[model samples]
Target: MILTVTLNTALDITYRTAALIPHTTHRVTEVVERPGGKGLNVARVLSALGHETVVTGFAGGRTGDVLRELLGAGATARPADGRHGRRGRPRPVDALLPISGSTRRTIAVVDTATGDTTQLNEPGPTVSAAEWTAFLSCYDRLVPGAEAVALCGSLPPGIHVGAYAELIRRARAAGVPVLLDTSGEPLRRGVAARPDLVKPNADELALLTGSRDPLRAAHDTRRRGAHAVIASLGPDGILAATPDGLWRAAPPAPARGNPTGAGDSAVAGILSGLVERLPWPTRLSRAVALSTATVLSPVAGEFDATAYEELLPRIRVTEHPAP
Candidate 1:
């Protein structure tokens, strides 16, 4: 099973309207709420792809209750006994730990007419020192059973900037491959731990490596400590720099829709491929295809299955020598 960690979990709420205009009152057409945070988003995509995924992190208060409810009645610590039952089918499970502070909410206002998304994100709840200790204990137990782990999203207040780095170390010690998807200082520190893979969007890559060029930034990031770097280039697709070689994967045509969670989908694809032992080119193709399919969906953390199936054969992955 793939284990995903969202240190700062969120209650994702999306508001859809006919048109989005500032300084004016507008009527909302639709509202959708789901359990979110980057790792949860990756878990959702992995689950949709028919993988058994376990999600762990901080959750508390009313929002946390609702998020767990959405995950099903069994989203708790007890079910995470680190044992996969010999059942008929495998499904996604939530093992989020409780905290004192209430979970945060992230709102996305989608303009249906123009397909524009404006997001307002809360900073998330503060985690205490005790809570962090408890989470690490739980994570250690989970890591041994996991085939791979994804250390994702931002660090909440009271948590150390090197949280992901520590988690990566634990996963490595357990002999489980780890993929890190985060930004800024957390990513910088985490990369120093030499994760199996790091997925950073173009902007995040630029911020970390001080290079506008994705290829150059990816290589630089690898040199910093990451075993491999997969830089998301938005519509241009993904540029991956791995020990095996360098490659670029792009969709046959640009997809249009909500871009939020697209990178998470790509992370899911890559992790899924890793656990399945797929080749680098095939893995890159799957990541690009999944990301494109996610862009075609209006909702975050979901992708159009039809689009994914159709685009899988069309994604182009080209290998190049490392610079």
Candidate 2:
């Protein structure tokens, strides 16, 4: 089982335009609304893959109600565990646990001309000190049931930068393996608590480690106290560094479709492996497959089962010994 904490959940909105131009109206060809927040996206995929997933974090207001409603409406929206190699069927998940504050929303304008995207994210709700204290109480209730915990996405207003540090400490005490995915100061401070895993995209890794190269950035990121680091490199796939060693996951085939939430999906793949206690190499492959699946999907932070199945066998992993 995996427990996912999305401090700032959102209702993801995607718009399709022939060409994304600044300050111009364009006809949208498609739109998708789902429970977002990085952890929620991972949870959605994990549930489809049959992992037991519980989600906690901040939510309130009508938007929060809508977010939970949307999530509860989606069948098997389980939290990501990173190991999605199960043979049979994934378990179903459609339960909604209440919390305070309405979730935020993320908008993506995808340009049909270049298949590129322009993303706009809400800063999220204000989490008063009392709200933060309340969230921890919810976490306390949920963390005990999970085999691993994934703390993902951005922080809302009123959330102290050190909040993740506190959550990491609690997870450590609970003996639940943790995977954290966020950026900026939250990512910076969260690592000091030594979570089990941190999955950052190339840009976030660069900002966190000040390295242009993803691999080097991942190497340095490990020094921040995370037990392991997995850097998602888009078409470059996932580069991972842990106490075990260093490994690179490269897809043998070209990736097709839009690239959105592939990182969160990859996080799910990684956690799934942790749940299965599979080797790191296998975890890397699963991450690659799940991420690739996300790109193939028309929606952000979503996965295409057919694409994932096809891509899993094609991902290649090369291992290097740790210094």
Q: List model 2 lDDT by residue over 133-214, tens digit each.
A: 7778878877877899999988878888988888989999998898889899989998889989999888999899899887
Best by lDDT: 1
Candidate 1's residue-wise lDDT over 115-180, tens digit each?
678899988888999999999999999999999999998899999999999999999999999999
TM-score of 2: 0.89
lDDT of 1 at 126: 88
Model 2 poorest 10 in a row by lDDT: 75-84
